[model samples]
Target: MATSTASYTQNQSILDALSRCIAACEMCADACLHEENVKMMVPCIRLDRDCADICRLTAAFIARGSDHAKHVLKECIEICRKCADECGKHEHEHCQQCAAACRACVEACQQYAGQA
Candidate 1:
């Protein structure tokens, strides 16, 4: 059975989406680490991990309504964008899915992060 997410205040959908994206990215990174051509995916996996961590933190910050969420979200967007771009270079299915997730999260983070 799938676990359901509880309701959160302010930007709940975006936060939930980001959390999912982060998890997918993390899983993809781990899978890439175990691939035969791990060396070729090292950098992409590294950034994927980094982006996942940042997205997780950003989601928590937003959920908690922290004052620093904006700053963190700004950084998270940058990381997500970079990671997505890197992941797109790979031909693996995991990488492709992770790239899509990261892009969605990036857009959400940027929208809620601060002024346009």
Candidate 2:
């Protein structure tokens, strides 16, 4: 049987945050690749990709009302924090924006986790 998400009404905010974070991370990663010092941005780019993927998965888990949503959210929070830290080290506009998005995602994940 298909899972119902009717009980997950509070997840809407988390979903929105995840979506924004994914976009920001993707954009940051692509911008990093085009930077003159691509080598220096490898860590940031990698973290951005990781953050985006984790957020995507977390969103899916929440949307499906999966039993493992909280577990996935824990990992998502960790990755988002790491990505934010890494991105915050850079002076690039994209990096700064990505950091902000990651931070927002972390907050949303934490809030959802608390309610779970």
Q: How badly does each model clash, as a count of residue pairs?
A: 0, 0
Off by over 4 Å in 1: 1-10, 114-116
Best-fitting candidate, scored by lDDT? 2
Give a tens-digit lDDT track for model 1, residues 1-116.
12223334337877877887888898898889889989999898889889988988987887777899888888898998899899899889999999999999887776665431
Model 2, 59-89: lDDT tens digits are: 9999887999888999999999999999999
Candidate 1 vs. true structure, TM-score: 0.86
Clashes, model 1: 0
TM-score of each: 0.86, 0.93
Q: Give the runs in model 2 whose Cα sits over 4 Å from its true position.
A: 1-8
